[model samples]
Target: MTVDNLPLIELPIIDFGPYLDPSSTAEQRQAVDHAIDKACRHLGIFYLVNHGIPQELCDKMSVIARQFFSLPFEEKRKHKVGGEVRGYWFTTNAEDLSNIPCEGIAFHPPVNQCSNGVAPDIDPASPEARLPTTHDALGGQHSWPNDHFRAHAEELLSHIVPLKVRLLDSISNCLGLSDASRKLVQNTVPHIAFNSYSSLTKAQMEEGVSNLVEHTDPGTITILTQDVDVVALQVKDSDGKWCGVKPIPGSFVVNVGSSLNRFTGNQYVDTLHRVIHCSEKSRISMALLADPVFDVVIEPLPECPFKTDLAKFVPKTFGAFYLDQVPEDH
Candidate 1:
């Protein structure tokens, strides 16, 4: 579809800064929660302005990313992802997302890394001990970039990770969750990735080639930042239409993911979305997928509307749940 024919329903934007402020009044926080509850149930994708991430840090991330992507083939390959998938992985056409040629670097901080989402000191006979997972391979170690990507990446994480926590708290409030369940955020293993896409030729665009195959993310939520003035993102509205996600200055595009839909008893939509093929400018986005650690079962909360219209919530462990959601071979 051309830009003009896009649906009239624009993805809503919420200035979450005040709501996330620790000193904000309950009314202020509740108002933001009301808006978020509506967005989660309907749009599932929205722009979060004043989300506390500094614009200067975002700009620095972009510059460092561009510099690294411009490096010589040999230099960029030095930290390539091999067996662990923890480093730079450059490819022409990715098997998972068609028409999008991109490179990605994965990072999983060890602070929150655990098979059962707890420290090793917990008693062995406890239920958490029985749930140790095999997917711990994706965390623990990371490849450092030789081209000054380390400093900026670290700083970005320091800022973005806590932002994820605040956003999660806001969402929990929207769901009317109690304090005990809200504390469940500690079990989340945040996986952050830096992605850059190559531009496609006009012929490819005309031939119906796509930037990314349509699919919902597998985690609880995805916080994204893209290069300014380059609009390649799209989200499927409730009516089965593809609509563009316009870049907003100093904002992050946060979307509900599948795990969250299950957690909320499908009250929120884990919206299907994809990157559009760009014929002009380059595409770069940093995404942090705040995922529940393995073995933590993500099921519907006790107060899920539990309507017949939604999918049945299952008490599926995060490890098995996320693996089954991986996009199948094209």
Candidate 2:
């Protein structure tokens, strides 16, 4: 269905430019507050603009993504999961094949060790099981055809990670939590996966052969950067009907995930969304998942009063719940 035909809700668009000013204007703070309220009350989704990230950087990242995914299957396979930490992955390979409920392993441990005397867990037998890969170096040493892209990817990561923290803090203030409560999530390391949806032809879109399946992101927040003209992303509304989201240039789609739901005591919405192929032209988008570190404890903000069962509302570590949801290969 077209974006207009479905029962989809429009989220807010927050501009961070004014907030970045040294002498912040009254209107700026009000704008931020308005955006915060919209995110908390309505769908926990919004389009971010003037976020300080350069257009050149965004363009370059998109180029790298398209180039990497366009590599020959054999070439792309060279970057496969030789170890758990970094590499490339094919579509659908991220599915957990051992959990009863069935889910995908979207988070990967940081490449470095944490300060709490905790070592990042590594799986020798199944490197693929540890995290999503981009290249296919199954049994070989991991390598990249273009090393320059690695630098760009890391740069993007550096900027985005901190931005996520700032956004989380805004969320905390909206909930009226103290600074200490906000810092509770400061050390929460995010496992990011840079995803690119390939441009599919009409036949492929009609056949539904290449698009992602219906599922909710399993993290605190999922930020996406998609092509401007493509029209294939869809979200299921409260009425159980699929609605399309129109592409707004220089705009990114943010969806609240399960982790955020737990952290906020269910004040935000973590709705179901998926991508469908369009016959008009090919499409590409980058999806970054920001999740808490595996060991960090998740609990509802104490200030949020709710009549619902506290046990149900209390948060749980993502790793504990994510591991249990791994699906089995039939």
Candidate 3:
């Protein structure tokens, strides 16, 4: 169910150029902060412009993603996930995502700790029970493509990690958070993903199959961009109606996720978004998501920018809570 009324059309398009400029005035920074705060509380999403990511890098990542996904099914299958959902795998037609077949990979930073148990209120049968690999090795290492395109693909993550740092810091300032609360965000090791959505016929689109099922991100924040000329992003408004969002050239779609929703005392809404069937062309997009080191506690701070009643936070550990939200297929 949705809890907001602001339409996606009127979404705030925030410019980051000013914030990054060395000579930017305090007033300009404050304006940016206000924009972030408003969008998160009202719509839970916003478009980010002038984020300083080179256009060439974005284009290169898209090209490499399309190239990799275009490989023969057998070739891609060689890199498939065995048990952990970290490498390349085919996305089957589930009931919710019918007609939209896709595949993607998730890459987490070096992590060795097995997931800590969930909060006392969680169920034993939950996905949270699926612990990560332990023993000092980073869990779920991604299987890089076997082709020359691998370098370009890997470089995408390099650019994305630093971008996430800038984003989280800005978000911290926007929330007027104390250093203690900000630590939850700063401790997050970025996770990068490359997704390729396959083309769908008109008939399949009419049959109600979307490129993805509606869901909210489990991480703290998500920064994503679609390939030029590809569109079909839809977000559920507070009225619970799906609204399409067209691509804005060279801009990124940013959304607060459920993790931040919890820690922010529900001040920042975790938005539900989806991609729909697009005729002819397959769509490629990449996302950089962030969550604190698995064991960090996510409790609402005493000071929050949005008007929220702090009574709702359940005080769950980041890793345990994120595992619980993983889709069964993953």
**Local distance difference test, each candidate:** 0.72, 0.60, 0.72
TM-score of each: 0.85, 0.76, 0.84
Q: What does candidate 1's lDDT look like per residue over 29-90, in tens digits? A: 88888887888889788888988789999888887787776676567667664534366775
TM-score of 1: 0.85
Residue 202 lDDT, candidate 2, scale 0-100: 54
The candidate 3 region of ten consecutive residues with least summed lDDT is 1-10
Lowest lDDT block of 10, candidate 1: 130-139
lDDT of 2 by residue, 1-330 (tens): 223244445657788666556698877766686686577456667788766667677778877766766566567656665443345555545332221111111224433222222433667365434333323211233355476776786687777777777677667666777777777645555654455454444544455443566777667787777777756778766567777777777767878877777767777777677776543444566666776665456667677555356877545565555444433221
Model 2: runs farther than 4 Å from truth? 1-9, 82-86, 92-145, 199-210, 307-315, 326-330
Give Cα distance to truth, residue 91, candidate 1, Å. Answer: 4.7
Q: Which regions in candidate 1 have their CA more than 4 angstroms from the true location?
A: 1-9, 20-23, 83-85, 91-100, 110-119, 122-135, 308-312, 327-330
